[model samples]
Target chain A: MRHLVITIGCEYGAKGNAIGRKIAEDLNIKFYNRDLVDEIIEEVGIPKEIMEKVEEGGTIAGKGAEGDVRGSFSKYADLTDRAIHVQKQIIRKLAEKESCVIIGRSADYILKDTKDIDLLRAFIYAPDEVRIHNIMESHNLSEKDAKILLLEKDKRYHKRHLALTGSNRGDRHNRDILMNSSYLGIEGTAEYLEELIRRKFGSEEE
Target chain B: MRHLVITIGCEYGAKGNAIGRKIAEDLNIKFYNRDLVDEIIEEVGIPKEIMEKVEEGGTIAGKGAEGDVRGSFSKYADLTDRAIHVQKQIIRKLAEKESCVIIGRSADYILKDTKDIDLLRAFIYAPDEVRIHNIMESHNLSEKDAKILLLEKDKRYHKRHLALTGSNRGDRHNRDILMNSSYLGIEGTAEYLEELIRRKFGSEEE
Candidate 1:
């Protein structure tokens, strides 16, 4: 009774979102990523303004810029916390229902304890230089600016992982597979992961 | 009874050799890389010339350039095969005797089945751009030339891995830790591996 469920955690610029998207399409399953934010909004009634802000380098934990749209940092923190809690519930419910690929939001840690489904937890990472180059090309930023934003985003991702799982993201023991996406490129990595999943869980349609 | 034995396999220009050197210095353990060639020569009675040629991409498997130095392709292949077989034995004996770090020559695959030591199998890699940048800077080669060499080296390495292990090196399941050395720089990767070794085998003296 091993249903296929994949959770992917990735460093910024690792093309994890692209890989997850491809895997979801290949598997013919639902893909959850930033769309989970909307689901959280629907499930928990978190305001869209705060969710958007939180999505854009705005941390719920009293640690972002000082452009308060709604209220104090603590208020947003509470809302963000509540939103994440609801997001976890929605992720679990989705996994229980059918096969799907979930990216980020500490979904690997969230689903680690589930027993009913076969879980493939993967962590994708790339070199800083490659990621910085990617950000510069994609975001129309200078080298210095891209480096700064990439590092900040990495810090925020790490903080979020710790906040969610009480453990660092680079801990290899926690992952079923750890890959360097820069070596394989986005599409190559997607193909690699697809083959890996098929090998581990068998090539059965969901 | 856990002796720290690390096998570091890396892509060209990933600075894996530098990291292995620093780890050897830091841990005060024997570091084996090309030195394995010497060991193989001594243990297997292979000629120094053939071993050196094989080490320098002159695979006796008829895959390399046509430069007949000593004998026919089949004879050199037989010697190279014997050298690798003897090298594997030497690697295991070294691990059984003392803590050490070995780089490349598929040490990860060789010592994987060892029963007495704590093995930390790591694969260090970097994006083509970053590795090409590194090669250009270090080897004083043009970017075009550096890229050519890097790809050729990667192809040779992949071929050797397939020859030795009968499996593709990029398979993530083969490694315990996969890191992008370009992200951490050479010294930083060294420090990272140092910390990882300490965590796995404790910080006590060997």
Candidate 2:
């Protein structure tokens, strides 16, 4: 079988990582999510959460709060610029290395022009109510708090995508599929996608 | 089997009607497309193309173009207001009566709150290159004209959808499934969806 790469972009609390991880496990392929981001974050000298904000072009509040606002903003720019470069290289390398499921970080856009690998780009999302409920249960937060948190992170997700790939995160053009998890739940969604990928780009062997 | 309503919203050249019609045929259900719109257009007393413009809140270019612009605009508003009411009523009545696949005219949104029918909402789209290619061959236009026509109609599709649904047509929340036809091609896409719908909401019989 040809090398296949599935890149997933999703809404906050949609369990995108959970879905990707499941597909990867079922297919017995490498799954890249935080480990990929953390590697880039290590280079940027910031935590994963902080990287989302910095990558969205937001200034780090600590050093810039009192003085040298421009300096701090550019400092972020430098970090993000470096991270973006490292991101593409790493994404391409990973896809070349093996068939894998990649979650976010614009893997679809980065690999858009690559000729050899089989690519399945998908976006997973759900209605706000389903997402809010997932967030509340998973994070041990109230419904109201989950709503607030969901909105905050969802914005940065789009901003971060736009920063890296010039295309809107939710744009249909970016994905081969966009699925809502409300009806099927995570396991079902993962199973459905696995079947789809196998049929679309499955191996010759059993 | 319970009555199932699959409402599909799609880009112009995605062959969504073909996909929906195939699913309905396979499932042995009613397929709705231009027939539903033609019914309303007869009442609107305008061509289908003109209705696309008018429903997007653009005034008719005739009957009051010179003397009474407001009159023409309000007349359209009245016609659209009437159309909107009829559109929803007809959509609900058809869905309530039988299992069907309804294409475009914001059928998904119109059926959003309907309680009785089992609804599967999908949005079909493809990359611009693929869509442009499809439109060129199907519409007998040059590549350049097809490109221009594609953009023009795509914008009006979204606008007409928003005017009726109060939600962006591409919003993931509005759909249970969004499939891109570029990868699978129309027949494969229809087959995939038929399998998916059957697995998810299939009848008790074989």
* Clash counts for all predictions: 0, 0
Clashing pairs in 2: none
Candidate 2 DockQ category?
medium
B84-153: candidate 2 lDDT, tens digit per residue: 6766777777788888899887888888888777789998988888888998999899999999998888
Residue lDDT tens for model 1, B1-206: 76888888888887788888899898899888856636654756766665555554435555523766545666767777776677677777777878888888788888867888878888887767788998999899999999999988888888767767777765554566576665457786777667656655678896
Best by lDDT: 2
Off by over 4 Å in 1: A1-206, B35-44, B52-77
**Residue B165 displacement in candidate 2 (angstroms):** 1.4
Query: Which ten contiguous residues of candidate 2 chain A have the minimum total lDDT?
Result: A57-66
Clashes of 1: 0
Candidate 2 true-interface contact recovery: 0.81
Against the true structure, what is each candidate's TM-score? 0.50, 0.88
- lDDT scores for all predictions? 0.74, 0.79
Error in Å for residue B16 of model 2: 1.0
